[model samples]
Target: MDPERFQKNAMYVETPEVFDAEKNFDDDGRIKRTGTLTTASAHIITAVIGSGVLSLAWAIAQLGWVAGPAVLLAFSFITYFTSTLLADCYRTPDPVHGKRNYTYSDAVESVLGGNKVKLCGLAQYINLVGVTIGYTITASISMVAVKKSDCFHKHGHQAKCSTSNNPYMILFACMQIVLCQIPNFSKLWWLSILAAVMSFAYSTIGLGLSIAKIAEGAPVRTTLTGVQVGVDVSASDKVWRTFQAIGNIAFAYAYSNVLIEIQDTLKSSPPENKVMKKSSLIGILTTTLFYVLCGCLGYAAFGNDAPGNFLTGFGFYEPFWLIDIANICIAVHLVGAYQVFCQPIFGFVEKWSKEKWSNSEFINAEHEVKLPLCGIYSVNFFRLVWRTAYVIVTAVLAMLFPFFNDFLGLIGSVSFWPLTVYFPIEMYIKQSNMKKFSFTWTWLKILIWVCLIVSLIAAAGSIQGLVQDLRKYKPFQAEQ
Candidate 1:
């Protein structure tokens, strides 16, 4: 009667037609990897160039033109360098070969080999969860912007067209519930490609709109030292915002959390490490160029008063249709990027559940339902319940704290030091076993400590911003 209890263990019931054929498996005894340099590059670009790009102009405004671009480049280099180090740890006993570490946590466990395994998993997954929440807030903001753009077009630019982001956040969570059912990271290639294209579309729109605004030849105040004391902001406000700006820039370059997962999708030949390094270079270079142009042009357009998100922040009032299109692209991009980040969390939970309750049929059972055109699909009670619950929780949290820039800055500041910088550096040092306090080791130590200090200051700034936001705003009542 239920039709659910009938189907079970399709993985083991694989027909001869599907299973008997000679299949390719990598050294890890999984499906043959299909990812190439291009796909990896696409994945990196999709992850790195996200809603965070919308804030770069505001980040640039906090620092001056000279320091802004310089800080962006500095973070870019640091991220790329640490990424390369982390890439080599994908394999053990050797950089190019040895036991394969399928995830970032696996790499940390293999190299560092202590309670650090749990630490890595906790930090990585917590950061991933935080990122998905940030995306929820951001996508909803863009969706609200789209509706407001139409209202502003029909009415005047000064019209009170503001709306709360809660409804859009729910809508975004609904979409993620569907997309999150896609199983695993390998199945996300097409989504990554599409999201990469969307990232470019919106970024180009923002850049073009900024150029148009600059061409209008309106005088806007800008300074080499940006937002000086008393003129544009108080001295303490300037300090807090400058640190928060670094956090925003860090958030823009945050592609490392899922680096090993992405690498695992690659074909084993040519060494995943080597290919990943190339992908890193390509992705970082392209995004950096876009960042420099968009951030600088947007600042020049609006000067010290640049909005946190130029496209949605009403930096350009006419050409409302173009602004709507850009916001649409941002929402679409976040849709895919959200899944890209959350799939890892899903995997971790499923793996833990299976291991913890190995014999529980409820956790391991699968029912196959054949459908028209889409073919047979497996439905698991646990996955449906758990994944939906996770998405709902993130949506609720997003509604609670919808301060976009400050939230992004805090998440970035907290995770950047541990996940991006500290863990990678420590893992590389242990894996390579260069002498303690050697030139390389000493410099790497310095880098990690310096990054830790920077992240702490950035996190403090974001906390201050959040405290300020809370003073005047009510939860679930934010409108822009």
Candidate 2:
């Protein structure tokens, strides 16, 4: 599609009336703006950094020290560029255009065509749902870890609590139901800030603890070869593990799904592109530094034996308070991170509900929900019900498939290309109308091909590994 047509269709993608200055203003007539540079950074970081980073040691173990950092840095650059590309494509040529692309799916529809919207929507749902499930798993497992450490260190005995993580997952999913009640994306900035801080806190503690272990003469393994530190695996298994690591790394860097939404939160006069580029830089840089520390130090401390999760490898010798604090931070951050990514999904579903149930009692004249529970307050009935259901579904999935790192690897593989790489590059190429065989076009094509190959290999490897493991432990089997 041409750029002009893309601009016109944006009105159909996002509501035009809500952009009005008067409607967006407060009671005192002060203009209400959602975010600044800092909050944008926080939201982006919260979206980008989650339990995926915890698997970096396993990722590094897959690719080894040398290739691990190399691939990590490579994907980091690729994701950063794609993120900025999305930001650059976020607007229209004419100021008179009634709408801006406010979501990734909107951008996809704008640039590609209305026909591609469903395709984009599918990829988005898969990515968002997968990430949410990953978060639920991480949060529940983190809570369990915290409880275990508390029981062991404080009581001098292991906790006899149910080994299954399902209860904790349910509890935290209930907490998400309450948090998800905050209907506005504008209000989630504060939560994002807290989540960002929590993510950093846990990562920093993990790094420090790893360093302390190294200082205490803990055995350290150093190698550039692909090797399992603590576990024995066949060469074929190691090969699949290395491929899955690509997915893990890709997953760690997958935030393009929410990039446009984060950009929409910014209140800068210079347009969101400038702020988005800066925030993306800040968020990626901070997260990358933490990932390096956590991955390398965790590996240095535990060698080939580093657990899939950096914090999960901690033992009784480690400070109980620190472990408790770190795990708490992880759980809290995942809670907020879940919302950050899920907001766009919520928006999409709510819009669809409005179209499908135009005359339903659940909705009011202003498109708000008519529920008695939150009736006095403006709630989207579809949102309350659907978002809650989404959380529950993810929580159930987390309980069913508790393989944290493997699940993340599978998701990262499945969604990375379409969400992170393909849509961004294709949108840029189409929107810019870049000449084929030109320097930019040629390199973008090359990058797209590379992403396709990597995504296929990673997806295949992850699915194989998951299927093999699932055969050993059938669904719903309680943890021993």
Candidate 3:
């Protein structure tokens, strides 16, 4: 069997005997049509909005109101543009052939060939794993906030929470182990929808609370440089801070990792690019609206004192009930967010398993698994263990490197150029067969280069920030 032909034919089968979306069934024996415009929009929204939103205020505070939202809107357009390029690459050979690209790696293999597939796979898993670790850190911190709120009521202590994040991280790992066992991407639709709602809910609440506090005469938070608004700061310090802010904004919109996979879930009849374009537009606009509102209001409310996480930071000043509600929303949403991102990682592992062991028990014939009454889900045995182990490993990493903000910036910077900017534009240029030096082609090259340089600088700054923060506070040590 020719490897190139196998790669193409694997996803784009013309014959029903090979693969068909309609023929795919879920655990409940229902045809698994995971991609509807609405559901796909929800999943995209869920993927885009994560713990990153919590830092938008800090990003804005660093750049101030004007440049902050400006950077955000710029990145939104860039992410949407690149993601559409990805969605367009979802199928190959003309509309009649209608072969689908089911994963980002598959799309890369189809357009860039098998050699580049591994590169895509590597960047993708790193991004996904980094995201999973970020979410674990989020869940644990949110849990710690909730616990500390209870402690505040019990003992009236106002300092940092006495509880460590490790226990809650472990608890979150357990939740992911169960959610990750859902067996197929199609099974996670409701979870995605719920996660979307939770994202909106917390964002809205955070914004509303900020507005209320500002109305009550809360002072604007000061800059990290210890200067009040309008006070002079060094140009070099301001420039570096703005650069870091760009990364935080970029990280907030880092959903390119799962764009292809989400499009794969769409119903096949109408053509995916059409639905995906609409979904991307809706998702980005929705998230952008929330981001602008949350970031602006949060900066206004807290000024330079804004916490990296809006809800967590504002909780110190806001009511406990509101704080608990917001954190709980975060905790619940990360559960589903973890599942959304982990599905691709799970698929990759299963693919490797099947290739290495053709008779592996994990690869489902139709991506379906039935639940038994034995209190154990009837997923493939190997899959259950593999996924469980994956979550456990991420949880441990979260324990070891619990620097959520810095680590998220690092992942975003590392992934933003490759997944979001580089591949999409390159594939678009190649797939579209755009002539060299043409207006659009020239601009695409310029965009790619600019993004690469900016991302590299941001990645370096993130690493530097992580090292400095680590020196001041060792991992696994209780926050003082």
Candidate 4:
């Protein structure tokens, strides 16, 4: 195929109209007014920092403290380099029109055309949905766990439970889907900012309380290796444990699509490439520092046996009032994440069924108004039903297999690795036409292979964990 024709075809590959405002350039080669750099960057950061940070210590504990930071840094380097390459491919000129524009799948199709691209695209979509669901379910459980703990229930009477069927979690997920349906990307940008701020604040406060507890001379346990204060797993299991750590790191760094979406959200000349590059750097650095601090402080304060959710775990030892406040904050923050995850899926479904259902007069016309200013929209009854079905499916899965962390790990291991590592380099080489791989490219390929291997190992471990939990699974139980 002629390179130009190939590029044009790739450019038009599944480019959704909803995203056109952000991705389409005007006569002057600038994106139409959609959102600002700050707004776009905030969304990127929010998308990246989900439940993975909370569980860093658990994974790192298996690898020991000395190895934890090193692993994190390595993952960060790999993620940043590969992400940059993908960004470069995205900026390549369109083959047909001689214009430079790209979509997430465009990059993939450029390298591995035909069935490979389709398979990868399908996997990417599934992974995105899976992670979103994973985050939603985990966040819901965390919210309810916090609420029922001594923290949120200080008053004798519980807040009237919103929805009884699947607990308030279903209700929470529904609310998020509704919010995401709002059509205004700009408005959604502000919401993303709020969510990102709340996440950082909640995590910071929780970490602070844990640190204060440690400073007050709380009981501290040294590692089995006799390290005064650090993570330690048995030496015999070091390699396997390191593999686990790599999986955790990959999970933490697996938001490249989110970053790409954010980049596409910008409305500037050539979309201000620096904005994304800088934002990603800031996001990764902030996230890594936060995780390391939280992990170290949490371990110092409560040791390895600390509650899986550090906030709830710390609440058991702190003042009842502090715990209550923390619970409320955590719940709110989690709700925000649920909203972010649900929005894209809602958009995808809405677009998928638009032709059949959107023009039907019987359908509520008010639902079709693309309210870009507010980033909110109404969905027809069918869309609502579809979303509800998704919620039900996810909730049933969560209930059937209530091993939260392991389930999350499994989702992360299976989906995140292919989406993040395997696909990016392939896209880059094919799209950019790098006939001879540079040293940097060669290193990245090696790193991606390593990540792929680690993902498989982690998937196996997570499956094992899930099986063990299922053998002893029980319905929701309040933390003792």
Candidate 5:
């Protein structure tokens, strides 16, 4: 088959079956379907949950409870409106005819052509890199929390502290990559189910404990005072800021690609199954409820001065068992995120290299050309180096920036804005034909403008937060 033509044809098809098969397996030895709506919903929920849950209260507390819900509502509306717009655009393009599978880059290319697409791609690449870094940082923090807990301490606390470097982190990352390399969708589906269960169990237990502590009259510290202090913003300003911060926090919930992938999976399922929409609704509702409960309980228990250390505040202090459980759950969640992040990079690289190395024409054409001796030519070497580097870099970053919510919100808001809000409205404008713009369309345009403006402001806030964090960096400080 012609390489170009084959590539074009494959764009509409689901990801190669081999890749799907490799990632689907449960801890309990069950196989699940990856392309189904249920799995898609799970992916969306898991992606949103990540390590952000740990610091959500801290962020929300900055604005207080009243402002926090407003922020949440605004972001929720933005997500729903923008997503539906994008989904409509996706539906406009016949899934089978043109390139059915559309990425952020594809959407950009369709609207603005090559130059703008390149810019968008760069932004996406940075966002992905930042996300990977954030994931690793969260994983490392979780690992340290587990190590410092009474469970590990009782085993040999002094010795464990002396050898603080976590080998299990590396081992887990490797295991995740290996699992993802498997090419069976059914297996990947099953694994997601187990992951979903583990995630739920961990979150539920932790949340329940947090709520119990709050009910027992735990004192909550107020980080921001309502009275204006010198250079700091007034309480009212802070409240508005918190409302803006909701838009940032809402970025965690933006998982448009996962939704599209899930939609693709459902295409093959029975038409009678309303699983995709139902699962999405269920997942979002479940996650939102959890978020509100955790946020309220955490604030009530730990206040604004919650410790940076895992499971320390929120009344989990001194309970080695609880800490250990939280740590393990967090680590497992990180592994899940790593799998999701790494899959696309792996697929892209694999496809890019296959043609150059495996094609007969390329081989024959290159026969007389001299290849560099030191450069990478062997796929085995590439895989080894790539996997090793991925783990090491991720681990180091995770340790350095353990404040997962800050990083997740910053990166997610910036990157997701264009994909979830701007591009969709742009596509709608380009494709829609109206003799006169209706009131609804006018309202949508206004909403889109608001999203774009708020997105920029939110991105600025997150960037400012990140900068402040970087300025306060202390080396080798123990996880608080």
Candidate 6:
């Protein structure tokens, strides 16, 4: 998009749509909301079921049949329950007929004010940045998978189809740099819907392949306790992997960071909280079911040796076309997702720069440039330089550490507790005026502490895993 349209279509991915007077304003004097339960649920599922799903099979493999499903269920319930509280916080002082909180940080500022607002902003921006990096890594993996699939199909099953991920990572980063020029690359509302569809496509394809593998006669070994310590892994590695698995699950359900953003899109007539609660339930259930099936079936097929990324990690070698299609879907999804996730970071930094150097022509000036296809768009020197630099940093990081499972787990563990748990719990209690020391309040406190501990342990595990991976591979030299 050119500068004119970029400024016109968006300041962020959730670009405002100008509606006529006939459209209901939802009593907030803002543009009319068209979001219904279906759209809301779609958004939730899209945000929740990202590349994190790629790790679930490995995550489940870390914690066997008994613990894996149980963990997923527990997370589903916790996420849903906390989400209802958060949905209510979308409107301050009242769940209905109250002041609107347009963003998560807005809700935090309105209900639980003070330094927590800064905390919320920090966590959100960091998570968004981390998400973009993760996407960079994930997209590269999928592209590499497409290539590897071809190599395996052309060669033989036993042939070494090994390769590095740096080229693909650079290619993906270059694509993102181009896409980033179009400020509203994702257009959140529509991308959410598209993401949900794409996620379903690839997830179903993966699940189908796993099921097909399991049906092939030979028995695969599985144990109630997952990967054994002595036989499969060292005891220390087991402990760390178990924690890392928890992080992976947390990442899969890490949608709370954007819950208020989705909730803000809902029509207020049905009570946004009511619709949001229902949507959260539906989304989590659907996502969890998909997750359970994928993780369980993938584990059933490969057992102890389940790959961190089943598609790209060389779990299946045949049916090259199907594999290529599934991976292509993932690549497309990540391209959109990366833009959506990174938009906030872009907005934040640009806003800060404009404010800090308000007098600089280089940072403030815009020149109109016409493109044949996208039409005339304004080009800002600062924006071009900053965005390009940002993409470079993320790409360099992805190249330096292409450890998929560990990197994803670290991102999840870092953002899960503060952004997802602590903020929502605090805002809910404060907004509802729930009495201190009450049973519910006490339980919420316990939930906060528990989740915080989990985040810490998960972070440790992920860091350890990254360290171990680094010993095996050099920076920018990551290989399958």
Clashes of each: 0, 2, 8, 12, 20, 4
Q: What are the TM-scores, per candidate, against the unseen true structure?
A: 0.95, 0.88, 0.88, 0.79, 0.75, 0.88
Q: Rank the candidates by lDDT, best first.
A: 1, 6, 3, 2, 4, 5
TM-score of candidate 4 on Cα atoms, chains taken together: 0.79
Candidate 5 ranges beyond 4 A from true positions: 1-34, 89-92, 95-99, 102-104, 107-116, 151-169, 183-187, 221-244, 269-276, 307-315, 353-392, 396-405, 432-436, 475-480
lDDT of 3 by residue, 1-480 (tens): 333333322221121234333355432233445479999999988998986787788778887766777788989999999988888888874422446677888888878885677887888889898898989988888888877776676667565557788989999998888778676586688899999999988887888888888898955644433323345446655566666777788888999899988887877757778899999999999999998988878788778656778666544544778778888988999998988899998888887777888654345322223334433233356776788899999998889888865778888888899999988888888788889999999999999999999898888777767777778877668744
List pairs with backbone clashes in candidate 6: 2-377, 3-377, 3-378, 4-378
RMSD to native, candidate 5: 8.0
Worst 10 residues of 6 by lDDT: 6-15
Candidate 5 has what TM-score?
0.75
Q: How much lDDT does candidate 4 score?
A: 0.60
Candidates in order: C-alpha RMSD to true structure:
3.5, 5.9, 5.4, 6.9, 8.0, 4.0
| Cα lDDT tens digits for candidate 1, 1-480 | 111222343221121233311254465545567899999999999999987687788888999978999999999999999999999998897988788888888888888878988887887887798889989988998999989989998998888997989989999999999887766577789999999999999999998988888998999988887777898898888999998898888878887999999988888889989999999899999999998888888899999999888887888876888889999999999998998899889888887898899788878888776667656667777888899999999999889878654666787788898889999899888888889989999999999999999889988888988888878777656595
lDDT of candidate model 3 versus the reference:
0.78
lDDT at 59, model 4: 57
After best superposition, candidate 3 residue 211: deviation in angstroms? 0.4
Candidate that scores best on TM-score? 1
State the C-alpha lDDT per candidate: 0.85, 0.77, 0.78, 0.60, 0.56, 0.80
Tally clashing residue pairs in candidate 2.
2
TM-score of 3: 0.88
lDDT (Cα, tens digit) per residue for candidate 6, span 1-480: 233433432233222345344452345444456788988887788778886676688888899999999999888888888898899998878888789987788888998789989988988987887788888888888888898899889887777777788888888899888878765322355766777888899899999999899889558778898999899999998999999899889888888887887787777778999999999999999999999999899889899899887887778877899989888888878876776667666766777788899788888776767666655566778888899999999999887767654676787888889887898888888887889999999999999999899889989988988888778865655364
Task: List candidate 3 stretches off by more than 4 Å.
Answer: 1-32, 153-157, 221-237, 360-378
Tens-place lDDT digits, model 4, residues 229-340: 3344445345554555566666777777555555656655445466667777777778777878876666566665545566544434345566556556655665665555
